[model samples]
Structure formats: structure tokens, C-alpha cells
Target chain A: MPAPAPIDPRGPRFNQAVLSVALLTGFLVDWRPVVPLFALVLLAGAALGPKYGPFLVFYAKVIRPRLAPPAEMEDPRPPRFAAAVGVVFLTAGALAFAAGHAGLGWALALMVAALAGLSAATGICVGCEIYLVLARRRPVAG
Target chain B: MFMARGVIVIVILFAIALAGRLYRAWRARLQDEKPIHPLVPDSLRAGADRTWVVFTSPYCATCGPVEASLRASDPGARVVKVDATREPHLAESFSIRSAPTVLLADVEGNVTARLVGAQAVDDYVRRPPSGVAG
Candidate 1:
């Protein structure tokens, strides 16, 4: 298989910082619109890659130009994997809230928020780490 | 009451996230002190006096610097770069859950020390714990 594309390490983390705030606000307000919007953000990131992701678009077009080039470029797979994880949580939360399971929905949303906030604040991508572990354990195809 | 609950929840979420980060950092540091004798893949076995096995992934930005530092620090030791994505089994054998994880091992493939994340070359060159015979 071909090697994955390289990305500025800051791009995903910046997107996560913005996402954490949106998620936190969505949970605190119990705002239904916030859920779908946040889910859309994660969906774009996971399916389309960071260049096409909304928050990352902002980072690439606006923030990245102002800063010096990154000392190193990273693989895009891990952050994309992280975005996939976010989509799972966000979709589940949104559905739960729509179904009137407010408590469960909020719980799931809070988990996403916490994980995003952790990555934003500390640059520790737990979802990415989990992906690595699972990928290693998966059986290789012939 | 509702406002207070929201505030409490937010605070709790942040606190939990921070705690998890701290715990992982602490654990990574602790893992460095002991020799876990991680398994080495055939491709990585260099048959050298000391081998620097670097576990890296495509998404690891800091990995390049770590590899460079290790190579610069010990010209004598063999440095092997393993792509965690392509060689997941290698990562699993070493119990590597994160990128840029460096394992210092002996000729017999016994891990002497493990370093996670970015560090100076000196950090990697430091002598391993005496308890485990290399």
C-alpha cells in the first residue's frame, strides 16, 4: 500500500480545539441543532480528510499561512481515525437526544467533548492511540 | 439548579480529561525505568551491541526528530525504524499504543529501556536499569 499523505501536526489539534468548545456548548445548552452541526463537522473530517474538513479548511487557509512551516509533517491517518471515532460518539448522542433519551445523549456528548478537549489541551490523541492498537491486532489479508 | 448542574458537568468533564492525560504521562515515564524485554521482529533484529528500535506511524510528527536524535546520539548503535501502520504486529509485540515509541535493546533482543514521545539524544543514551541483565 502507498504511504499516507503528510499533514501539518497542528491542523487536527486546532480543529479539535474548536470542536471541543462547540461540543461543550451543545451539551450545556441541550441545543438540538448543535448535535447535527457538530456531527457534520466530524463527518467531513473523517470521510473527506482534513483539507476538506470545515475547521481544517479554516486552519489551512487562514491560520497555517501566518505561522512558520511545521518542523515535521505527520501522517493524516491517525487524525482521520480520530475523526471517525468522534463521528460515532456524536451520531449516537444525536440519535439518543432525538429519541428523547436526554440523559444518555448528554452522557455520550460529554465523553466526546472530554476526549476532544484532552487532545486540544494536551495534544494527546487517545482515539488515534486506540486505532493504532486495534490496527495492530487486526488480521492481515492475503 | 439547572445552570449549576451544567457548570458542574463541564468542570467534571475537563477534570477527568486532565486526569487521564496526567496518568498517561506518568505511566510512560514509569515504563522507561524497567526493561520489559519487548519482542522484536526479524526485520528489526540488527545483531548489534545496541539497537534503537523506533516505532513510528505516518501521523507521528515528532517521530522524525526522535529518530534523528537517536542516530546522532549513538553512532555505534543500530537504529531501526518500524512503521507501526504497515507492521502492526511489530507494534503489538512491543506493546506500543502510541507513535514515536523508542525501545533500546541489547544484541540478544532484550529491551533495556523504553522512551515514549520526544526526548533529547542524551535521554536515550542514558544507561538502562541494572536489574535486568541485557
Candidate 2:
């Protein structure tokens, strides 16, 4: 049989995000050792976006099909869209850090931070068009 | 013995769901395998702890509240999110095909529970101890 098509890597972004959210939650709950670890991963995902982005794409499109045979018309737009959203988070994080809004920055970072976790719990991505409707648009007027 | 067992069918079904979650918890338990340059790790376990392994995707909407409920209750079980996008292998390893998947594990590499669909936190509330292997 012909090889099955690739699963969308963007799909797992939600899961990965959810995982991180949970880990951060633990940090929040415990507030001692894990915050740094969470920060490291958060920072890394940002710095290494290009590297990991493609990997996530491949995983979502090609790899996911093996175990979870995707729907015929699975949304192919999430990874592309999530890249845009990642920028939003990184920008917010940067601004917060720059303006000395550590608390605000953390909160903002946490908002975008929920991406992968949201993905993991479901196939619906925060970056997809549907999310564009559910989530409020940014007020920056960009 | 048979009569006693037959009397608790609801409890038994609940037990089955909990049993299936064991592997999910294990897969979630799998730490994000190491990455040399701190980019996204190839394995789903990258940069994650054992407590959280959620098999969800970018499109799934139902998982949100379920996750919130779980975190609200335990406050420490940290839910590791795995985008079927990033680590499909990890999801396969745990035998999860559905979105909004959840795996409840401990820090010691043991998966005690898993839920495949959107489940309420009450689904996992105040139940008997889970039955995952060491």
C-alpha cells in the first residue's frame, strides 16, 4: 500500500503547549524549582522557533497520520497560523520584559503559553481561523 | 463473588477508563527527550515532566475546560501538553488517537490515568487509587 500521508505537525503544538502549561502550573503551585525549567523551555521554543517549527509541521502532517489517521480535510493552516501567534507571544513577552512589566509579561506570556496544551487536549489550534473568531483581536491595530 | 462484582457495573466501567489511562500517564511521564541546542525536541517528552501528558491538537476546542478543571483540582499534577503535531509518535506510543486526551501521571514515571475525550475533572475526582505499573 502507498505510504499514508503525513500528519500535521501543528496539531501537536497544542499538546506540547498543554504539557508546558501543566508544568508551569506545577511551578505556580509549588513556586520554587520548576519556574526556571519552564522559563528555559519557553525561551527555547521562542529562540528556536524556525528549527522546531518545521519539525512540528512534519510531525503534524506526516507522523500523526500513522497512529491517528487524520481526517481527509484536516485543517492544514494551524502551523502557519501558529507561527504568527508565536510572534504575538514573543512580542508581548519582550515588551513586558522591556517595560519592566514582569508580572504583566508573565501573564501575557501565559496567555500565549497555553497554545500547545490547548492543542494536546484537542486537535483545534489557537492559531486556526476558528480561534481567530473565538479570541479577541489584538488592539495594537497592526 | 460473582454477585458482588456484578452489582457495581458503573464502578467497573469507570475502572476500565482509568486502566486505559495508565499508558497515557506513562507517555506523558516520558520527559521531553533531550535536545542538543534547546530547540523543540524530536520526542514528545521534550522539556516536560511526568505529571502532564495531554494528547491534543491545535483544532480541538473541548480540551480547554477539561484541562482547566484538572489543574484547578490538583494544582500540582502539571499537564504536559503534546501536540499531535509535534510528537505523533508519542501519542501512538500511548495508543491515543482522539483529541483532548489527558494522562494523569506521577513524577516517578508512572501513568495512573488517561482520558481520551473531553472529560470533566470530576471524571477523575475522588476515585480510588489508579493502577499503573512501576
Candidate 3:
């Protein structure tokens, strides 16, 4: 496969910030629907591309215009993979909530929120790091 | 009820963050020069004057590249690959929770350096085993 296109490093941080806040709000409000809705958003970004992601597109069109360009761009694949991870956790959390397991649902959602918050605050994306490790498995020339 | 749930959420968030921090610290500890106590059996231990025993699991994506890189860096060096998943006891004995953990040992089976994770592959390649021609 061809290399993934690069994106503004700030865009992912923006997405992470929104995701963290949304997830925490969902948990605090005991709004079960919020988890799955955000999961769908993440799924769209993972399955399609940054252009299809509401948060990323919003960043590109609105937030990005207000700020100067980043000094370096980053590969989009890692963040896309991170979106897929978020989808998995949120989907599972929604399922748990649907099954009346509030504790499990909250645990899953909170885990994702914590990770997203860390990425947003410290720029240390655990899911992206996992993606990079997996990406390195691709056959390299001897 | 909502207030209680809010507290639960905050607690869970803190728990996750604490777990992450603890994991990083543990990994760092494993990277220190901790010898392989109660030396491994002859079948699994280093067979040469200097060897790099790479503990890997089947699920580890970077294991193959890490092994390949080590071999490429030193054609004559002894590189042993042990599947941690298959050998759970061995992995447990060495306190190996992660794959691609490279342990450098001398002829006596005494570990000199402990490198873990994909990042360690570059580190080992940069500074190979001492007193042995790379």
C-alpha cells in the first residue's frame, strides 16, 4: 500500500480534545446514546478519511484558519487507526450500557476519555503509538 | 444518582491514568540491567560467547522486524528467538510482559543489557555487544 498522506499535527489534538470532553460529558450525564454517536463519528473517520470526520473538517475549515501552520506534518494513518480504536471502545461501552451494565459501560468510556485527554494535553497518543508498532511489522527491505 | 455517577467517572479516569503511568514505570524498570536470575536452561540460554535473546510473542507485530534487524546488524552474532506466548513459564520467569524484549548476555549466561520494545532495536544496532566483532 502507498504511504498515508500527512496532516497537520494539531488537527488530531483537536479531535482528541473534543472526544475527551464528549466522552466525559456522556458519562457524567448518564446519556447512553452519546457513546454510540461518537463511536459512529470515529467509525466514519476511520473508514473514510479526515475530510469525512466532523471534528477534523471543523478544525481544517475553522480552527486551522485562525492559527498558523504547524512546523511539521504527521502521517494520517496513526490517527485514523486511533479512530478505529476509539470506535471499538465506544461501541463496546454502548453495548454494555444497553445490556444494563452501567459499571462496565462507564469503565470503557472513561478509559477512552482518559487516553484521549492524555493525547490532547500531552500529545502522547497511545493508540497512535500502538499503530506505529503494528505498522513496523510490514516487510522491510534487507 | 448523577452526582454519584460523575464521581465514578472521575475515579475511573484517574485509575486509567494511574495505570498508564505505572505501566511506563514498570517498562523502564525492566530496561535496567536486571540479570536473568536462576539462569535459563542450556537449551534456551545463549550458545555462543555473546548472544541476544529476543523474547517475542506471536501477536507482537514488530518482532519479525526486530529479529531481522538484529541479524542484519551482526551477521556472525548469535541471535536467539523465543516465543513468549508458547513458553509462558519462560516468559514469566524473566518477568517479560511485552514482546521484542532483547537481552544481551555473555558466555556465562549473565545478562549485561536489557532492551525492550521496538525502539530498543535501533539502540542495540547502534551499540552492539562489547569485545565481539560486529
Best of the candidates, DockQ: 1
Ordered list by TM-score, greatest first:
1, 3, 2
Q: What digit string (tens of lDDT, one per residue) describes model 3 on residues A5-124?
A: 557879988988898888888878878787899998888888899888899899999999999977545667778888899999999999999899988987888888988888876677
Off by over 4 Å in 1: A139-142, B24-28, B31-53, B57-134
Which window of 10 residues has the lowest lDDT sum in candidate 3 chain B?
B33-42
| lDDT (10s digit) by residue, model 1, range A1-142 | 6556678879999988888888777666667667668889989988977767999999999999999988556777777888899889989988998898988887787788788878877777899788656665662221
Clashes of each: 2, 59, 0
Better of 1 and 2 by TM-score: 1
Model 2, residue A117: displacement in angstroms?
Answer: 1.9
Pick out the ten consecutive residues of candidate 2 chain A with the lowest summed lDDT: A133-142
DockQ of 2: 0.03
Q: Which candidate has the highest TM-score of all?
A: 1
Error of 1 at B15 (Å): 1.8
Write the residue-wise lDDT of candidate 1 on B1-134 in tens digits. Answer: 56975885669666867777787888778666554555565457657877888888755667777788778767788898988878767677778766788887777877767777665333545654466332
TM-score for all predictions?
0.70, 0.33, 0.57
